[model samples]
Target: MMVTNLCTSPSSTITLRADEWVNITTIPNKPGTKYWVSAYVNVTGGTISLSMYGDISASQHVSYQITAVNAGAMSMTYSVVSGSPTVTVTSMLICTFAEYQANKTLLDSIEYFDGDTMPRA
Candidate 1:
């Protein structure tokens, strides 16, 4: 059985006022596989906005991405972990078939200036 685990430290960190946004990305060292991803934030007075993408599966390794949008100085963190394959291997070592592997990818965050500017509907 093969397994891999990955995590992001500072699970929560402050973003300075000058900072527009926070972006994080992760690339697994292993081949095609699934991965589980999670994120949390700790903001005292102000509100914290968060966005995350990528495979959340525990069966294999996968690329992950996270972005945070905050009103003021705040802290946030994201994590990724991988687990064993979903398929079961028998003692006889008989060959079995499974679904084809698919690539997982995520996009980084993009900060927008001027809160007055509204998005197009």
Candidate 2:
């Protein structure tokens, strides 16, 4: 399984810029598979918005694009403007069909067959 992770921390306030793009790539790169992508941010006294592309799945590998938006704090709500937004990806996983099939075959081979039924102990 291939995995990727991203994390971010912002002090006070920050705003995201257009040029700044958070990208996660080079997963398994398998077709018909699903991948899991997630984002996590640790910040205090600030509001943040997150956006990303691609669906979260565990059967395939995929890429994602994420963005973050920051809202100013109460003290600077009106006077202070949010700085560049920062985004952090928390976790990613690529589960390909080949891996799944291999696991299944291994499991099947491990089971003991008795007469007409197979028993797993």
Candidate 3:
């Protein structure tokens, strides 16, 4: 259940351009393990795309889950689709698989009620 910050510097942000991928950071890959990667970014002009461990995500605060299949470094990158945008990578985190499973277990234990009967599961 270890949590790690993947950004190289916390006080700085990276600006990206259209059709260009900017490398944020590269994290260590533990084979057979799962990691949840999330980032806090501000996008101006257009939306931005994020990629890590071959998994892709987009916009603002988003998380991408991926499993480590080999040993090495897993790099995270970002790109915009339209005009050059100023982006602030406020926070980036990589959570362990156990933490994810634990959160899922907690979510599964909850029952949502919509007035009279509970909503469909």
Considering every candidate listed, which one attains the maximal lDDT?
Answer: 3
User: Of the pair 2 and 3, which is ahead by lDDT?
Assistant: 3
For 95-115, candidate 1 gives per-residue lDDT tens digits of 001111121121112111111
Model 3 scores a C-alpha lDDT of 0.50
Q: Write the per-residue lDDT of candidate 3 for residues 1-121, one digit (tens) a residue.
A: 3224443443345554444545544555789988765555666655555555222233455556878777665444466545655655545545565665666554234311111121211
Q: Give the Cα RMSD of candidate 1.
A: 20.1
Tens digits of per-residue lDDT, candidate 2, 1-121, equal 3212211221112232333433333222333333222222322233333333322212222233222223211110111124433333322322233433445554335332111121101
- How far does residue 58 in candidate 3 sit from its true spot (Å)? 9.9
Instruction: List all candidate RMSDs to the true structure.
Output: 20.1, 16.6, 10.1
Best by the TM-score measure:
3
What TM-score against the true fold does each predicted structure earn? 0.24, 0.26, 0.54
* TM accuracy, model 2: 0.26
**Model 2, CA-based lDDT:** 0.27
